[model samples]
Target: MLTKDELCIQKEKPNIKDISLELYKEFSEEILFNQIFVYYFTNGTTMRIEFREWRIYHMLAIQHINGKIGKDRFFSAIENGLTLSDFTINDSIKNRYKIYKERITMFLCMYSALKEANVFYLPSGKVQNTKNAKADYIVFSEIGSKGMNIGLMKSGEVFVPMTILISKPSNKMVYLEDAIPMEVERLEIINIPIKEKEQDSEQ
Candidate 1:
């Protein structure tokens, strides 16, 4: 658990891949079984972002059955003082443990991919309509800064600031094209081996 004051202190930026892999290794079981898995990372700045995973596989299972991918998305909250309980969902999925493991694995993979691409380290600005009345750091697409004249932003050009909350609902993972609010037609896809055997074989 990270506090606001602790998050305000500047620290050296840890390798995103290392942090993600470590967190996955340490908390994989908690992520699969718990209602939510919460963690924090600092970008070598006075700001840190909160990452959360929620268990809502029954909804996802229905969406999967109906082929509805719209709700299968991540959420960005710019407000402060938000926590795991703030993002709530009913859980009643069949074979929830299995689905939870699958969804959490996919979610962590997508998260690591985005972090490697620096999607969460974008330009920072204040967001409106946030839960907290006070202004909070919000990360938006490059187009949001440069206007619509520039067309779609290519991969490696997108940005996100620290101090915001990014969350993934339990479901099939969607890439940045669907995750972020940008006119990105495609992003450079990175192949991340999620299984130990696959990693070992790749080595």
Candidate 2:
């Protein structure tokens, strides 16, 4: 069997064909996808948008999902997290996700739409990466200076699996995107509102 890297290498030229088509075609019911609205805790909405913008390593650790309706659609947060050691990214889907993941606004739209479908991901019921440059959902990452260090959200208690990364010879995370389902369950933490700004009281 070929290693993930070897399989990823074979996927350089993406074909418009996939085995999932048969399964997708067989689906009869038209399920609705909901767009989860994640109100930021400390960082605020801007911070949530930040992680959605920079596909941080931590953000990629969790499963992200999206869908469309007519010409327009939405995005949402679901409850699911994948471990680095347990993710497997398919070729075509991997490339497609990479293309879409880069677009922040659109990604959020997808995230929101997914909410309509009632999707949400809460790994171990604990969201990490609070120091994320802009905590859209609280998950973030810090690579080398010259390199692109992702800073995204931590919808809930999910960890960005090492699987969804786009492989960089210098940065191995790049090859991890495969395991990251293009339409992964959003990582939205519920019943636990993030606390912004600590109380600053002095005598």
Give TM per candidate. Answer: 0.21, 0.19
Worst 10 residues of 1 by lDDT: 144-153
- Candidate 1 per-residue lDDT, tens place, 34-68, comes to 21112123332232232222222221122332222
Model 2 Cα lDDT, one tens digit per residue, 153-179: 354442221122222346533322222
The Cα RMSD of model 2 versus the native structure comes to 17.1
Task: Tell me the TM-score of model 1.
Answer: 0.21
TM-score between candidate 2 and the true structure? 0.19
lDDT of 2: 0.25
